[model samples]
Target: MSGKDKPKSAPDVPGATKAVRKLGDELAEARQLHRLLVDPLLNTVRAERLRVSVTRSLWFFLACGLGFTTAGVQAFLADGYTTADPQWWAAWLVEPAFAGILITLLRWEAEMLARRLEVTAAVVRKLKRLLLFSTLVMNVIPTVRPPDGHSFNLGNLFVHIVIPLIVFFLAEVMPVVQEMCTRAKDTATVPAAPDVDLDQQTDEPPADIVRPAVAPVVPSVKLPPTVMTQVRTTLDSVRSEGRTPNVADIAKVVALPDNLARQLLADLTPVNGHTVPNI
Candidate 1:
């Protein structure tokens, strides 16, 4: 209860408070720099990596489910056959063969859907259903009616039924998942379009100085008076129709080069207090 019994307060080291303040300031600055520079790069990498991880995880689980279903189908097909029989060996391949076709079709469908194509052919739908139904029927038959007078197994039946359905649904849903992931990855990776200010655009030049009568033309060559007159006539006709005479319009009417047409337009139109230079 005396002062000696009380623990001494920790001594304050010189500049400890200032050191802490300096450390906090440095950390704040580092965070700001990280956000400004490192975060964008990390975010892009993370998005692509995350998408790949998700796709791989889906495939891994689907593979496990399919393997389990294939084992069930193998058992059902090999039930009455001896190990030495060729039919017994062949039974192992049935589910995988069906699964291979299903995977191929689903992959093709996924690629097509990712590219925004429709896959509405009745044959494709029928074929997919047929494969799934065949696998389901094969997988569940042995469990539902056990051979050798063995009692029917509820556990085996449950597994046989549920695993095949899971495989079928996984097959059906993988394409959709792939399409969504592809779209999301594309959206994240595509660079944004640069912003434009439409108000700054104008048909007229910014200054009073006249542009060349025909850009990049040899000074030695000049348009004949008849050609100039024809250009003027075309411009007048365009104005009469209540349409602005642009380079394209002038070129179409007079069969002039685009550069010459643009120059001709500039020469023909008067800007503020500026005289048109003779071509």
Candidate 2:
């Protein structure tokens, strides 16, 4: 293609990166708001599904890298090695590249507040398993793995096994990282804004402070036995799924009018520390 015919790339603006980041932050905030106001429990499940996807993606990428590395090295060293230098492959593969990344995870975890369902490092704190796994991986390679090479060399053990084990220990001992983590709960515990009474603050005391007539409290209307029975059944079904019943959802599930469904929900109370929806 001629130089003039080629499409020109857009020039990067000074604050373009910052602007994009701001947009992303706003979007994330909106998502959190939706989760809180719309479907907290359902959104929790969705976030978990997303994390599983991310973890699987990472594993797939790592596997692909392994395959590519194997093929590329084989291709580069065209002729099969009658006497291959095991040390060269050991140097290339034995170093734990991800050890530092794991440390960052540890640091982040250390900064977090403890949760009710707290994580324990009982299993991971053991230095033995990390050493065992890294050593085993090193052994399985053709170029003589680190821990148990063709010969039992002290230098090989220190470089291949010791270092990797140290890295793993740091990942666990510094701060144990959970396989799954979560942000702190944003439960609707904040008190509603206090009622403002501006007239009470006036300098002149009123002769007769006329309090507005209070509206009569509404009585709970009794429903038909059949409808009430259906509401009870539907709520039980919802609770079984570990979800608190909402007006719209209860209406759909029980085939009741939205207003009636809301009325039924009002009669119920929050139990077991679960937040009832503000229907």
Candidate 3:
């Protein structure tokens, strides 16, 4: 039939429109949950970000510390360490320096304790937003005329405003901060799957399919008491670190030379719920 002769399409029916809206809502909800899983705000990401926020935002912390320390240094330089001029370093630390020192110590402690990867992600996100708005307001400060008809100096512009703006941008690049942005974007999107042709069968097996097999049982192998204790300790350590205990860790635990440890591991069928290496 000619194109013109084809039947004209009908307008949307009430039932079909309702179905479409329902589908869209469901899709939106699914996308929200998917994004939450992909990028949680208060999980390990937050902990990690919190841990690095001080170090990553170094310039801000350093400046604050210096401002506080400057007064003390100046006092020391004034000379004459009498009762009036105390030389105590601790006494010299002021409010600004105290904040910096506290933050530095916290960050250092977290690092030693195995810092979280995104401990400061949320904080950075919020701070970056606040700083961006503040920058806009502050840049206008120099342009405003005083009652005496003189404009303020923006001579310290780069040091005070520009550098901070740059730091805010830098903070946004952190892994946790990026995750929050992605999470926001993801929630706004609808979940969608690619069109699939069910009738089109592929020659290859599905990736998720598992094939079971029967194997001959091997005789049990036993290790000496000392070796068993060492193996247990190594496995425990590996588990605590959230990893599977492999050949290397086992060797370290038992203090067995590499060749012997490897041979012993191979001989065992399974140890402490894990299969021996090379089995």
Against the reference, the lDDT scores of all candidates come to 0.69, 0.45, 0.46
| Runs of candidate 2 exceeding 4 Å displacement | 1-37, 61-123, 127-129, 132-279
Which stretches of candidate 3 lie above 4 Å from their native place? 1-14, 18-54, 81-279
Give lDDT tens digits, candidate 1, residues 98-200: 8889888987997786554557899998998898888889888988888787898899899888887887888778777766654444333322223333446
Q: Which candidate wins on lDDT?
A: 1
lDDT of 2 by residue, 1-279 (tens): 997787654334455576786886787777666545544455446655654565455444534433333332332333233336664454444323333333334444555422313345565334335543544354334234322334655654444444434434434443322223232111112112233344357776467755446843333434434334555677778888999788865554233344545655766545685634322
Candidate achieving higher lDDT, 1 or 3: 1
* Candidate 1: stretches off by over 4 Å: 1-44, 116-118, 190-279
State the lDDT at 93 in candidate 1: 91
- For 1-279, candidate 3 gives per-residue lDDT tens digits of 998787654334445566677886787777667656544333345444543564456545545534533443333333344446555444454433433443454444344324222354565345446544444343334334222455555554334445445434443334434344333332223222333343466776479854446633333333444445546666666778987656787644333434545555555425576665431
User: Order of candidates by lDDT, top first?
Assistant: 1, 3, 2
Against the hidden true structure, what lDDT does model 3 obtain? 0.46
